[model samples]
Target: MTARDEIPLRDADQVMRLSRMGSFHQSRLSFMRILLRRMRNENWQFDAPDWHVNENGVGRAVYTVHGPSRAYSLVAFAHDLPDEMRSDRVIATAWDTTFTLFDGIPTDDDIARLAQNVPLQEAGRISVRELTLSRANRSARLWDFVVANLSAGRQPDPESLKTVGYVMRTTAVYGSGKFGAADHGTIQDRPEFAAPFQAEMLTVYLIRCFVMDLLDHNAKCAGGKRAVKLSPKLRRALGIGNSTGLGMAPFLVNHPTLLHQWIAARETALARVRGIKTVTDGERDVMIHHAKSAHINAMNWHSQHPMQIAKVTELQSDMVMLCKEITRIGDAPYPWDRLYRWAAQNLTSEGLEQVVSILMEPYGDVVDDLADAMSIDESAHFYIDGTQAMGHVKSLIAKHFDWALKTDFGAGDEQARFWYVSAAKLEPRLGERDAEQGHELEQPLAIGRDVAALYRAITQDETVAHFLRKHPEHRHILRRVQMVEKFPYAEIRDNLLHAQMMPIDMLRCKLSFFGATHFDPRSDRWLRICMFQNAPFPDELYVPGNWVYPEPTGAI
Candidate 1:
């Protein structure tokens, strides 16, 4: 048996705490890396057959990716959105750019139809032929700076590029039957999209291409004959940015089975890498290079939020200590495991997670296969097992949700926050239990409180069938308890309703698996992040690439 097979996965209690989940960093198991690796291995072909934008930057572009058995196209519409109409709220009626991922290469008829409706956003309707619907706004400050500099035949200052990280930030990217788009089941069978969010990832990837093309187009329009395109190096340095808010926090709670699969794949990958008995000099060098690169990423990551600012500062310091410690470790048995143990003892949560991320970079052969197991058939766990005895259910709840059962929801502080959907926007919003009008309409996001309630109600020994027959209100929570019994890493062991709960933690956990970086939380409820920020573009996928954290900007 392999050393990895002998090493057990980390306990759910340790892995699923909100604080630790919030500190998660992207690893080889991240969906973005998995998608890119597959595309590269399969030798997918890409092309932009249409690019028709005017001097005013109002036009359409189509980027298509042709896999072995199918093709998908990103149809983008650029608008002359005045500064006043540009807002990030879902209620906003207009945006600088809108996009839809077409099931295949779109025709002139499809583009015309989309041009009329895609720009309308939520107000407009998309057909089932669309796989994903999305929109973005240019980074007003950096967009002009980059365009002006490139128009003047010079590259924008790299420091400014690093500060912003991406020229355009997406407001939303909807998939899985949202807004009339083709449901995930339509294309889930394709090998290219067997993993979760592959279509969404592909949409964002093509959107990055469109953003770059649009920037260059506008720069040339402004500079005329003197305009220069962004340098290849500078271009690759930019990624697609996203603004995520409370609407995403519920996803983790609502999709526990899938969550377990994702966390399991990553933790399993870490254990596999940790179990390596010895590392060659070449492997050590690769790990060192990635470590240095991650340090560069830490140095460049800028955030205005106070908590994130402190994290960035601590991470920068941690990287320095990491460099010093890397030199001290000598050739020995289970060297990778030894390093992990050292990190657990010496590094901050943020820094330790970063350490775990880089460690997996050099062992792709050991961990890449875990990507295939990250998707789950959630429906398989949907039906409640009525045969389970009440005592057995209580035991399962006590084991998986001991933290939940301990929460004192009677205290106002413990139930200070409530999640509800906004009537104006119909999206998730966090409201104060004491001050907001919607506390009575709260969603069942307070899983911990509900579990505690269930524990109290099931004081006597009876079958789950009897309890459910008497009180159907507890059925949902009962199903969850039964499900968690099998899926170890399924529950977030924090009080979501607590006044101190950071919804950003939930957002960060999900985004980390998407391979995002430069998490700049604007508020506790929402944050900004960059995707594929040092990743290779579709055109560059054919070339040997090292698009990992802390890219090798010559100065670094």
Candidate 2:
């Protein structure tokens, strides 16, 4: 494609809006897909060298994956807790299972040491030899149903599987030095973990494997001679579930440079696909197949929250419209770009972003490489140019923080919410500014509001160095302001403290990048989502195809 035919990346202001970002769908660039593609290409091998669980399901098992140059093992400890004690809250002290990803294969002594700590979760301490620490609780209803049916030599009802996608849902997956696990810096240079969250994603992937095996073992013990194994089709239908809350919302705000890299890479991929001058017949077929599968996924996606219910309803309609539009693509130049422009005009933000994701499905060769660019050494962007003129800083604010400048923060609703860390768990929480206490200890996550205040504080033309001498409070935002001048997509262009701002939107934006689906919000503050649903297990990694969306015939 020539320069004239090539489309430019979408503007940050248009693309970084919280509403649009929340509407994003996973494409081939998602970390999970990137990790899976690499494992398959390298011909990784997976095995469970140790399975010590008894009939009561209270024992330990180790699942390990041998890669090209390294091996990581997931050390899992199963518990037989009473149903009343099982909870998904962060404060919960017990779980159905707990796990830690070891840097390499662990010996009996290493396993014994981990056995004492992994199950304790937050109360436990790990060493640098571990990469991640996590805990999960079983979906009591689905677990019971599946186990009972399988033990009696029967498959689970597909509709029941559809209603609750996973047998167990992880409440928390702590990594990167949290709870004393290995830091990202220690493992980042490794080829396997070069992409963001590959270590954690691999942990969850292997956990899924263990979860399936544990279920099979329990069924055999209960039924004796009549027990049957879960079919591969049903096994592929389930995935690891995750419960996320406000703790994740501030991440997008705290790591501006890293967030920019992710958004820029995705936008670049979309631009490249849109620039394609013509689509071959095989490429067109791939698009049609994924589009139909996306439609089925939309129809199958379930949520009880009114907001998500409405969004899913709109997405279903959008997919139908998209499939019909795909049928009309004839011998037109730049057909993908044409379809994108049509979507921009005709569809809602939800449908429009869906089209952007679907368009990239047929062009993996052009987009897959972008995954490598998703991660960065954020410390390189930490230095502030204190010598910059105050005039230049104000102009940067004018160009990037116009949305913040125009907002009326003095209004009660404009600043109704405040984010703060709870003293008990030290996790981020939101409170009503007017009715709630602890607004005095608010965190520095209200970036737009802070930028507005910084603009007002600049009263004279001088160097930023001199300004910081008198007012050091503006230092944090000043660094961010300078960063945004170089990275346009570095900031989320919205008021995070507004009363109407749904934290779920921020959570969904980050989770979608992790390749999560079935966003079921339990409330505005927290939600349940499924990861790797319809994805192949490690044993089936050799099978090649896009498995993010289910096949039409596989739909419930």
Candidate 3:
């Protein structure tokens, strides 16, 4: 296929806007969805060769996954962790479980070597025989309840799930050459995992299966080994839990080119649908299906945080309104194009964007093609081509990102804060310069303030190259400015240091793309989200690609 044939031609302004990116929801183009697509297309087979979890759920287990080109294994090390040690905090030294993705079945010596380092997380460096590395902790309150209820030969109250959904929450799921695994460069060519972030998703998916096994085994071990397995429907409702904190905030800023690629692909997919001048009766049916599915999913979404609850409720109301308007023009020609116009004009940010997310579902042919090209040549677009004059650079910024320029960083509250990497866990944390300490080693994530600084410096420059020679340190921000000039949606529009900054919004933007549903906020700074809840299991890849946004009954 030619360059034009690869991705749809989208407006640079629309794709580059950060607020739009921050507002993004998951679509068929998400990493997890595409990875599942590739996995199923390959007809990957999974086998459980070693299942030795004792009745107490403290034992060893191994799952063998057979891909077309390679055989991989998930070697799990489960242990008895005291209540004090089972913390989800980044500062915690231990977890209820640790697992590694081996290239193939390991020898006894290999297993022994891994057991030494996998649990150490950041403290220990793993060597490169591994593909992905991760660790998880049990939900403190829910784990004991499941054990107690099952030990009494009774099914745990399924409603108990309505609160803290998953039994285990993964502290971190690392891949792409993390610790000692093969860096993405070495393994990106593997057809099974070429799509961005697929390895991480697969690791979590397999972990979900392992957790179910552990729960059932413990019930059997405590009760009479006659404990009933959870119904497939309830199992389908469960998801791999993720306790995301500021650990994820920096990634969106650090990987500019990759961020640009993700938003670019999404915008391109939407543009293709909006430009569609015709739709058959069958195509109209698909669009309506997506609309209703989205409405139900939004309605069924649950969260305790009032802010998130309000956002979801608004989305539900908006989805209903959208569904009503959608039927009015169902028989019209180019139905999807009209629907796009209506949504853009009427729906709010959460609702309109979510509709765009769902619309991509009905046209998998388009979404699948765009989703195929996930990896990006980020370095290729890294440098600021100095050929353009100072005026030209500033002009693009002013025209495309006037909102960022309007931010008043001079105010105490606006620039009063800083983001730091914690020494204990090496995770990101936000702090106030006046109210708290640690402003000395602030991370380079405050893009709005810095980009404005670079903008003023460039305006007074004699030449673009001369400007860089005098201020080489601002090279990173310069590249980002140049990139945002082309891909407008790449940066967040809001000031990060402002008192009203909702970090949860930032987390929601990324989680929604992982096909996460229930966004229960533990606090403004951190939240709990459920991933792969309604998603098809590894065994169901044989079914269809349109199983992502399941019906309300199916969507957890």
The candidate that achieves the highest TM-score relative to the unseen native structure: 2
> lDDT tens string, model 1, 1-556?
2345346778999889898999998888888988999999998898854888899999988998898888999999999988988788777889999999999888899999999899988888999899999999988899999999999999899888988899999999999998888888877888878888999999998899999999899999999999999998889999998999988999999999999999999888888888888777888877777788888889888999999999999999998888777767788787778888899898899999898888888888888888999998788899998877888888888888898877779998999999999998788999999987978888888899988889889978888888899989898898889989889888898899889999999999999999999999999989999999878887788776477575554522
* lDDT (CA) per prediction: 0.88, 0.90, 0.74
- lDDT per residue for candidate 2 within 1-556, as digits (tens), equals 2222468999999999989988988888888888888999899998755899999988999998899999999999999999999998889999999999999999999999999999999999999999999999999999989999989999989989988789999999889899889999999999888889998899898899999998999998888889899889989999889999999999999999989988999999889988888888888888888889889889989999999999999999999999998888777898888889989998889899989889988787888889999999999999988889988999999999999999999999889999999999888999999999999898998898999999999999999999999999999999999999988988999999999998888888888888888989989989999998888887778876667888765332
Task: Write candidate 3's Cα lDDT for 20-52 as tens digits.
Answer: 544567788887788677778778898964886
How well does model 1 score by local distance difference test?
0.88
Estimate the lDDT of model 2. Answer: 0.90
- Root-mean-square deviation of every model: 1.6, 1.7, 3.2
Error of 1 at 534 (Å): 1.4
Candidate 2, poorest ten consecutive residues by summed lDDT: 1-10
TM-score of 2: 0.98
Q: Score candidate 3 by TM-score against the native.
A: 0.91
Task: Report how far off residue 209 is in candidate 3 (Å).
Answer: 1.3
lDDT of model 3 at position 115: 80
Clashes of 3: 10
lDDT of candidate 3 at residue 337, scale 0 to 100: 67
Model 2: residue 522 alpha-carbon error in angstroms:
1.2
Where does model 1 exceed 4 Å of error? 1-5, 553-556
lDDT of 2 at 517: 88
